[model samples]
Target: MATAAPTPNRTPPALRRKRRKELATAVGFLSPWLIGFCVFFAYPLISTVYFSLTHYDGFNPPSYVGFKNYDYVVTKFPFFWQAVRNTAWLVAVMVTLRTVFGIGIGLLITKIKTGAGFFRTAFYLPYLAPPVAATIAFAFLLNPGTGPVNHLLGQLGLPQPGWFNDPNWSKPSLVLLGLWGIGDLMVIFMAALLDVPTEQYEAASLDGASPFQKFRFVTLPNIRPIIMFAVITGIIQTLQYYTQAIIAGQVASGVVGNSGQQFEPGFPDGSTWTVPQLVYNIGFQRFDYGSACVVSILLFVVAMACTALLMRRRAGLMGED
Candidate 1:
């Protein structure tokens, strides 16, 4: 038999020491992020968990209450349930509208052979606008009395809605405002659409597939993962809907004061009130940190449940693939 190959020499101690030094250097570089995580994320999360179980206002010592806050939120807080219903409605409607419009716009853009860059920029520029600025601008444009939108609608003899002022029209106005920012999702969908294999398209064409058939059978399936990503993220975002609603509530409620001023949020009889708004009202306005923490934990649980459900669906899809 051939002589056994010489065993590899053990790593020299110097090399091992050098590796250890490099590892230390790498860790040193990561120290800031690691420290930030522990301080900001870990500490706050742990504290929230602890405080959610106790009654703690900002100034007073935390009183160990043991689920009373949660019970109160579940049973006594009337607005809490309304916030839940409103948030659920927002999540359902926003996610569906964003997905449909985002994909539709993306598909349309991809079919353009000329000035595609211009069209892409035009479509995506809205997403680049600051959220607050965009919401303020939309508030102006949708103003019930003096807005240009209603003026034009009047010229066309259409019913001019009381957008932010009227309770019935408030949520729909927010939905319309959300659609203006669908550009982000559109860009993602465009990327996914462009990534569909041309070979599949060719095969479908050879099989005499119509455009709709090709899209339904090939394009949609290929881009399903991207759509799912957009939907899940959209769901999470809708659950946390706050800034736009608050700004809309403030501006439309005819309270043109400093944004910092303590105005009742979710105006029009609390029609625009959401869970995050409720949490803010509890924590900062009422100084009920314990109840706020409880609400925060509940939101966290809902988000985690949604994420888990999506992950399970993703696992099933992957298995099928």
Candidate 2:
């Protein structure tokens, strides 16, 4: 027997109107963000990709020279590799040290029963200092001949090596600066540590687990997600590191912008030149917009790749947990 035709599955008119109104409200709320994304992010990204394949200074019309900019950056550009190396070194060393130091400080603060808020405020104050001002202050403090730090070393008869002025020590000095301002990371870790259930710790103690054992099996497992988030963000931040390095280099080299002469970044034999600094120097300083765009694209690729890898690893870790 033939089945009766199914009733039309149309929504009630009132229901449909309500749904449409809700959708309109949602779209209205989202419009500002959508406009901002298009104007600030999407437009700039598309422009960068287009410019990477062309030769253009700000005043000149773009001439398409497809991939030559990339080739020159890879092969002929003198400081490209140096910038890459410096950026990579910062990402590896600075990020690792910041993570460790942040956790250590966080743990220490958590153990403090009295005036923990004061200590947190003191630590976080350094992060509030403007980056340019901070870098300049640090450079002056470490100045080889006249700075108080070197003077103290002299009085103590310790061998005083130039910090930002020395190629061997510049990156290390930047690491120290990074650690000094790691209070943001510390705060995050502290929150995570505090969030860990005390019941787990009591349970572990009942099992006669050592402090380290409890931390490893209980605390770490509970806070693994926060740790991963910190690490990922730290890596991304380090990859785009610019201001401090440039300012430190400039201060150390005593290269204030002089009559039509641009101050070269990554002073002290190009030791502290980072990829982002390179992009700035190329695009604005040298007026090589195409090459700058190429470097930017490469940097974008590297950042995206690193983030993807870390996210995948985080997923695996969460699965294991």
Candidate 3:
């Protein structure tokens, strides 16, 4: 007996309604992020790009000037090269130091037996601290005199090094300070270390390999991707560094703009004005919106080029495998 023409297979209305409901629910969950991206990132990105090609005073309509802004940054602007040099120094050195320090810390902490948990939390605390508060703390910590760091050195009969005060050491001091809040990097490295199999270590030991040999061959290869990840992200983070440099820059000049006097060049003898800060000063402080837009577009191109080169290099390396 043929089963009554088994009902032509189709989704029931109830199931169709449920699927639609699920999609709607998923979209609802993403609504906040979607709204934020559209309003903040998407809009601002388009607007800034448009503004960069124009001469816009906040009060006036933006006037298009073709590549004049970019030309000015590349050709006429003196501080443009200075800002590039400073930003490159910070990004290159800090990214390198952060990667090395984070990996070293992760390895050492893992080596500990009984106190790893406590030390991990303690070391990671800086990353959790509000950036402004942490920077202020660093400011006090690096004060040439009266600060605890300097006071302790004096107790040891050593000269208190100028950290934030002397322009000569300010960039280096900032790089060192950057290491303090590198818990995020350390944590990422720690996870990669954990992914390494104990059996692989045992096997390497069986071959009578030294600890460094095992690390060099097995551990390093295993963790290369993680290290590359850190490098890319570190580049992005350090390139975006502003709060520290801005504070440091403003302090260096020790001058504020007024009706009577022009604002000084940069912080602490103009040693710490990274590209973004330079753009801000030119645009707002100097009232040369045209130069600011040029500086900004150049900065955008530099950042993009740096990121693309890094990512493309990585892609090539991966493809070779």
Best by TM-score: 2
Show pairs that collide, candidate 2. Answer: none
Candidate 3, residues 1-321: lDDT per residue as tens digits? Answer: 777767788999999999999999999999999999999888877777777788777678778997777787777877777777878999889999999999999998888899999989988999998876776678777778667998999999988888777878889988977999989988999999989988999999999999999999888878989998898878877776778776654433333233455554545666776888777777887766766766666666777888799889878988986
Q: Flag clash pairs in model 3.
A: 249-267, 252-267, 252-268, 253-268
Instruction: Report the C-alpha displacement of residue 290, candidate 2, in angstroms.
Output: 1.2
Off by over 4 Å in 2: 1-23, 257-260
lDDT string for model 1 (1-321, tens) is: 799989988999999999999999999999999999999989999999999999898998999999999999989987898889889989998889989999999999999999989989998999899888898899999998999999999999999999988889889899998998888998999999999999999999999999999999999999999988998999899989999999898888767666656688778878899999989999999899999999999998999999899989998998998
State the lDDT of candidate 2 residue by residue for 61-99, as single tens digits.
999999999999999999999999999999999988998
**CA lDDT of each prediction against the hidden true structure:** 0.92, 0.92, 0.80
Query: Clash number for every model?
Result: 0, 0, 4
lDDT of 3 at 82: 73
Task: Give per-residue lDDT, candidate 2, residue 205.
Answer: 97
Pick out the ten consecutive residues of candidate 1 with the lowest summed lDDT.
253-262
Candidate 1 residue-wise lDDT at 24: 99
TM-scores of all candidate predictions against the true structure: 0.89, 0.92, 0.82
- Flag the better candidate by TM-score, 2 or 3: 2
Could you tell me the lDDT of residue 179 within candidate 1? 91
Could you give the candidate ranking by lDDT, starting with the highest?
Answer: 2, 1, 3
